[model samples]
Target: MKIKSVNLETVCGITSKMPENDKLEVAFAGRSNVGKSTLINGLMNRKSLARTSSQPGKTQTVNFYNINDLLYFVDLPGYGYAKVSQQTVEKWGKMINRYLDGSKVLRLIFLLVDIRHKPNQNDLQMYEWCTHYGFNPIIIATKADKIKRSQKAKQIKQIKETLQVVEGTPVIPYSSMTKEGREEIWEYIDMVYEG
Candidate 1:
């Protein structure tokens, strides 16, 4: 799980075709402004390789990061941004769906949700879509550092129950600020990729 080399390998827009990559691919999906970029930056041990902005929906394209040429960390475009029009959202949806249906080496999908709030309609729908795609997504509750230590279990339980995840799904609480749960996430990834 040591990151020896990382590159912003490819950027696929709505019309762009997904790379026919030979390496295993892991993807991240979440609502707009849910710290996906921050998580990616934390995982890569980089400051801003995956652009992080205060604004939501900044990532409009599917970004593929090459991790030591071992695998591709695919960042799907963020969903559920209110500022954009419905047509734009639909385009993003179709683009995401295309990647999900088309990628051959896609191994796992990590669905991110905010730890402080109940998953909204978009979150529920995304979870359902991931399941429908035949992926048992590992949920990552982001911004864990914002919550109190005592509230961790309750929040995690709420996430699991709200998503109604299948048994044995791992929901790791992550914080970009404290970098807590980063190692656990990497360990889980290693187990899945190397076990």
Candidate 2:
């Protein structure tokens, strides 16, 4: 899973706008400001390949990044941003749902969450949606570097319990700052590609 070339293919506001390529797609889905873009940039070993913004709700579209022309890393719009209007939220919902449902090349989804807090209602709902729609979601607890080593296990446990993730699905602790869990994440992605 060595990434040789990473290119931004398109920024899709709706499913119809998604790239028509048939390459395997692994999407990153999570709430706003959960460090989705940061994770992607870290995973690719590119500092600014995916834009990182201090402000939440900056990613309002499905951003497609082509990796070595072998796979597509889809950055989905973050949900549950308070500043966004209801109409905009609904539009986003439809766009995400359509992309998830219609994409045949979608291999797996990385559901990112902030490691510091409890899983909120939106997080629970998104997890449920992934399960309901038959997408294999690997729960990623991002920003792991913010927490102490002693608290890591407890935080992971709380996230598992709160999210009610079952035995098969994994909840991996990850950090963009330290590149922690980066290899493991890629291993999982590799497995998905193999499958």
Candidate 3:
């Protein structure tokens, strides 16, 4: 995954049509405030291109980043924000589902969870929904830098148990600030496409 070029090539709103892309697609799915934009920026080796925000629910649309013209990094709308209205949340859910159902080039989905706490109900539901859509989402535990080194194993175990992920599924702990676990993620991505 040598990122020779990266471009924010597509932005799909609630009613916008998903591009009929010809490259492999990988999606990132997670709750709002999960540091998704930061992770994406790190992966692209660029700062603030994905638009990190102080407010939750800031990314209200699906963003597609063309990566090296070989793959598409799909940033799905963040879910499970408390301040959003029920109607708006429902629409976001539908929009995500629609993209998952419609994309023909989609190869994998990475579901991010905050590492400081056990998986919540929304996280569980999202995990289940990803499975229901025929995806074995690779879980990325975000905010790894916020926790103590001694707590890392325990928290990762708790997250896996709470999500009830199948045996052998990946659960990676990632830190945007330290850029830890970035190479492991890139290796996994490259393997999935190259192998």
Report, for all candidates in order, the number of backbone clashes.
0, 0, 0
Which residue pairs does candidate 1 place in steric collision? none
Candidate 2 residue lDDT tens string, 3-118? 89999988886545666768898999999889988899988889888877666774578889998888889998888888978887788778887788778888889999999999
Where does candidate 3 clash, by residue pair?
none
In candidate 2 the C-alpha lDDT for residue 184 amounts to 90
Report the Cα lDDT for residue 79, model 1: 85
Cα RMSD, each candidate: 1.2, 1.6, 1.1
Which model, 1 or 3, shows the larger lDDT?
Answer: 1
What's the lDDT for candidate 1? Answer: 0.89
Q: For each candidate, what TM-score against the reference?
A: 0.96, 0.93, 0.96
Give the poorly placed runs of model 1, Cα more than 4 Å off: none
TM-score of candidate 1 on Cα atoms, chains taken together: 0.96
Regions of model 3 farther than 4 Å from truth? none
Order candidates by lDDT, high to low: 1, 3, 2
The residue-by-residue lDDT of candidate 3 on 10-80, one tens digit each, is 99998899999999899998888888988999999998888775777856799999999889999988878
